[model samples]
Target: NDLRMHFVEHSTPSKKNIPVVLCHGFPHTWFSWHRQLPALSNAGCKVLAPDMRGMGETSVPKDISAYDVDTICRDLTGLLDYLEIDKAVFVGLDFGAFAIYDLALRFPERVIAVIGLENPAAPHNPNKPPLAEYREMGADHFLHINYFCEKVGRADDDLLVRIDEFFPKVFWALSGEGNYFDTFKFPKETHYIDALNDPPSLPWNWLNIEEMQVFIESYRKSGFTGGLNWYRSMDIKWEQRKPYENVSSNIPAYFLGSENDVDLKGFHGDDPISLLRKQFPNLRAVEMVSSAGHLVQLEKSEEVNTALVRFIDDIREEL
Candidate 1:
């Protein structure tokens, strides 16, 4: 319950530009936004990227329920309150992007705008089948969601047993150049490690050796249970937010993803831009970076930064 979060802040003395909060996805730290920090900061926005609860230097509770979306959103808002900031723009990727959308939906007043990367703004589908149903449907495919939703400690144990071996394979398979869909053809009973490391593609061009080492070392020290807990709370998050089922984010929102993002295409299997437009009435723009993958920010930092800066500037102009 007492989680001391860690964040990297870049603020100008003038305090002239809009403040931007960057949130990273699972198994990633605030360092995921390392490239965007200076770019956004230099472009005049005050940038804050925090390692969400249970990741990086953040101190979090051991209980799984503590990682729910409501708790995570509170953590971000609490950080803002701690800093005495009123409202700010939010930028996020993957699960981080999902949290930003949740915040906007639940507390639109706290967000001036939102720039989401790789994840879309699809509203909760009340009729969507449960995880167990999805698992049965995905039996032929080695769906990580089903695997993670297993007995609490099962997924965490497997990941800890092969943290080094697991992450690299995941990174490679999910990269733009990787054969991501091929893994689905593997047998249902295939172990995640074996499926992840199968005929691996080394030296992922998007991520260099040093970058890979940073993530590997960070997970090695922190372990993967905290991160996995976020996945465990997916169903709970949906259930808890039932009151807000019909709500949609009314704030200015933009989505930037990659054409090669497997999650965008393979997992969701819906046109993100179209669905996002439906979910967010005030959505400003939807962009897809070519030759980029799930880690679009890291793979095409220049383009991503450019789009982000433009979005912030445009939002500022409107205000």
Candidate 2:
């Protein structure tokens, strides 16, 4: 259904049948996990990373509904079916992580293992605050989530530059300064003054320039609407997930977050280990790597990779 899917396989074939399906989050493509592909592939798992509905080279859907989590998750299942694989270890980061949660719950048998990189939300995470509350936090700071919805047509209109050219700069600015545009191009020695003057930490600054550019190019051509469409479908997602309201995933699960990842700290409002453990009682491992930030796989690949390998290795027989 989606035409933009630019799926990339690893450089080598798997020595075993331990296949893995990796997913990317909003404002990113499968390219986000480029560093981990070869490592995982060499570790005896067939790894496949597809550009989710509208992010990378994936087909862009005209009907925004096509971007809904149910359909997007189904797209991954369809890819597996196309490959004739029964199930695989699924990994997602940020919005990609949310999609994985829905996938595991909706089709438990198809998921061998569930891993979330940064923003991990289980079926139990409370409903997000109302739009009004998020809006009060200010439009510039977090406009990406609700930009496509009807409520903020004004703000959307305000940011109407071509998505391709505009988003990279936006991401660069957000990732660089922390909160939106609080501190763009200022002296580091002036951080205290900068904080007092423009407060958001420029979280994207965690990424190296090259990494940020990769996202910019991918999102620039792909457009963020399809990815952003995930937010619009929240109501449909809620109703769809309601059937599984009582479901608690029995699959081995792991949640990894960076202690210094401002995105997670700013978003979750609690210690990730405590929050995720409480939400997922059967969670096998909850790891926090202090050296890393939002892009755990990119920032601290070895640590993230080691933790991931151990978890899957321990659970392979069950899978």
Candidate 3:
């Protein structure tokens, strides 16, 4: 479990230590935010972006339970302690966004600010449709929640190929038909076809053929079990944090989803903007990209960068 802590630090030796920790979600490495690192560092923030557990070059833990939010968040907390940082801004996407949510909720004392990409506030169970509805719609990805929560052992043993295959499918599925299968022939990334098609988007930007080869090679060498363990640990995390369901993030926050992105539509629910307003009472701003997909960081780097810089400036003026 100690292995998943890979980090890339960018600091310009500034007087005010605006330490910011960025977290990447599933199917992405620290490479997801490659465009933002230099910009943040130039802006005078000490930035640390890490490939989370089971991700790029990070140590993959053998125990599935280690990847739960509590344990994973502790891994980051321990990472901060190791780096001697008392607190920092937390920026995250997808699963990373979920972890950030948990971080701000479970350890608000340690967070300076939080920004979530794509992930909105926690779901209001009453307004949420039954899981069966999504299943009936033939999107089984969320169904993995049930497997992760209840059928860990069975899923652990059986779903390796499926996960590997479907992982890439999420990218195209979320993008809708216009981009479907088009993401398949992106040069040498043919091998991770399923993954490229799945969650996260465009290997060409963050990962070159060589990089992907390295990842696939490492995966074979390391075995997929450790990475898969993360799925099995979710139920444990829910029980641990069940008492804090009503908690809201007061840290200055931003929620940006791609307006053209279909993948985030369902998750965004009926009123995405209003949902964010309810969840983030102190939410500083909300923006959506009309032409981009779920991979807003990559597709709309300029806007994302502007929004991020603006958020930091707002806080600086407040201070």
Global CA lDDT of candidate 3, please? Answer: 0.66
| Rank ordering of all candidates by TM-score, starting from the highest | 1, 2, 3
Which candidate, 1 or 3, would have the higher lDDT against the true structure?
A: 1
Q: Report the error of model 2 at residue 266, Å.
A: 2.9
TM-score leader: 1
Measured against the true structure, the TM-scores of the candidates, in listed sequence, are 0.93, 0.78, 0.76
The best candidate by lDDT is: 1
Candidate 2 segments whose C-alpha is farther than 4 A from its true place: 1-4, 122-133, 136-143, 148-211, 269-279, 317-319
> Against the unseen true structure, what C-alpha lDDT does each candidate score?
0.81, 0.66, 0.66
User: Model 1 residue 49 lDDT?
Assistant: 94
Question: For candidate 2, lDDT tens digit of each residue in 173-292?
Answer: 333233443432333222122222332322443455576567767765655566666666666666566666566677778987776665675556655555555545678877788766
